[model samples]
Target: MSKSLTYTLLFLIMMIWGFNVIAIKILVESFAPVTITALRILLAGIVVMLILGIRKEFRKVTKPQLIYITIGALTGILGHHFFLSVGLTGTNASNAGLILGLVPLMTALAAILFLGDKLTILRMIGIVSGLIGVSFIVLNGERSVGSISRGDLYIFLAVVTQAVSFIAIKRATETMDARLMTGWMQIVGAFFLFVVSSRLEPDGLSTLTTGTPVDWIVFLASAILATGIGHMVYNKAIHQIGAGETAIFINLTPFFSLTGSYLFLGERIMVEQLFGFLFIVAGVLLGTGALEQSLRKHKQKRMAS
Candidate 1:
């Protein structure tokens, strides 16, 4: 696996993820948000389980690991997906894509608060920048006060929940394989989502059968390619190249998502959204220490020279 090939694969994975937002938007047009999300997650979990079985990686989790995995399942899978699917119903995919770029910064904040990670000056700046960037998207260049939409608020909540889940995921992965944890989390999350959807959306399951062939295709691709295989490849890239290198690629996701929204859904991109993306890129670089690491390497090379 050459670096070039690995990078290309990562880029494609990001594209899949970006287009998945568009797929969700399309699916929500005909299916209930919670119902479709639950079904997709359930399918993704089964796919992951198949992969784990092929690799013979299944094992019993300790009580502590189970606790963390449960937390991750609830926050990352159940909470995040619920909000994101519902959010896309009330808002366009383009806005959701841009707003999700705040995940890295929010994760940084979560680490500082829950994991006792140090808050450096750069991180502080990054936090402010990311928040401002997301606010721009939420406001969508409107001059009127209170322009924030409910969907935008839900998207932000999704980011927050996912960020918190990262903390538990980190803990769980210390004593367990990430793939295993992910598989279990998805299964557990899907169960809860089913329960929730049944209570809130009595006709949700029936709506699944009402989708066209195209809708089913998009839904399957989003679940299998984006959620199932995408996660596996991403984790593999982290193992091969390192987490920092892999994380830098995440900055490309919003752009890919924006492009997908434009091409597939015919959504318009606003100037403010582009500007917000710039802030988000800068924030992720700073917030995730990618910028700091690059500077350190440069300084080291200069001293050696």
Candidate 2:
């Protein structure tokens, strides 16, 4: 595929993810957080399983692969959703978007710690800045400036789970098929959530029966567009080009998410929050070594001019 087309598709996918955050905040008005997250995971898992089964890629799993899948089910699926659903219930959708901007940075830090990836001086500074920025946002209360309510703590927890999951995924992708692992992880996570929700939330069983038409549409969109198909297309894009090329598009996710929140959900941007976001983003770029490449590109453009 041409570069332009690849980028266009990635852009569309990020838009879906961006819009998904807003959609969840809206849907939470009608559904419990646990209920929504469990249902979404279950539905997405079923869809991915059918697709993989049709492609004959759903091979019998080995014991080791099952272990990895189980770990991912715990961290990536169960922990991440629990944090995210609760976080969105009390936080600003825009805040969730900005805080999630830490994924690349957190993943890079995890890589350095666990995978022996290089951690440069700049990246160290970036890490510190990210810490300070996230702290400021999470520690501040609702009446405080640039505060995103106390729910920001849940978002940070979600980031921690995601960063850890990235490590698990890196190990799995070394030998296992990424899509299959993801599918199984989803199934495992969904089962965990279903059982837990059944116990914790009184009306969890009636989640489907309780939603209106709009809620169901939003729920399906969140499951299919933002997650199930989103991850599939993401992996395919990485296969077509490379992880780095695909990753530069991640910078767009926050922008799209914040914009969607602002336009659709009427979220207002805060200066302090924006600064914190920039700090976090800078940390991600520098920590991941993508900043150097960006600088090199700018220098080339200047020399060309």
- CA error at residue 166 for candidate 1, angstroms: 0.7
At residue 62, candidate 2 shows an lDDT of 81
Give per-residue CA lDDT, model 1, range 1-305, as digits (tens): 88999999999998888888899999888899998999999999999999999999888899999899889989999999999999999999988998888887888889899988888899788888887788778777663446678898899999999999989988888888888888889999999899999998999988988999999999999999999989888877877897767878888889988999999989999998898899898898888776787788899999999
**lDDT on C-alpha atoms for all candidate structures:** 0.88, 0.80
Model 1 Cα shift for residue 25 (angstroms): 0.8
Error of 2 at 113 (Å): 1.3
Global Cα lDDT for candidate 1: 0.88
Backbone atom clashes (below 3 Å) for every candidate: 0, 0
What is the alpha-carbon lDDT for the whole of candidate 2? 0.80
User: Per-residue lDDT of 16-85 in model 2, one digit per residue for the tens?
Assistant: 8878888878876678788778889988888888889999888777887788788889999889888888
- TM-score for each model: 0.96, 0.90
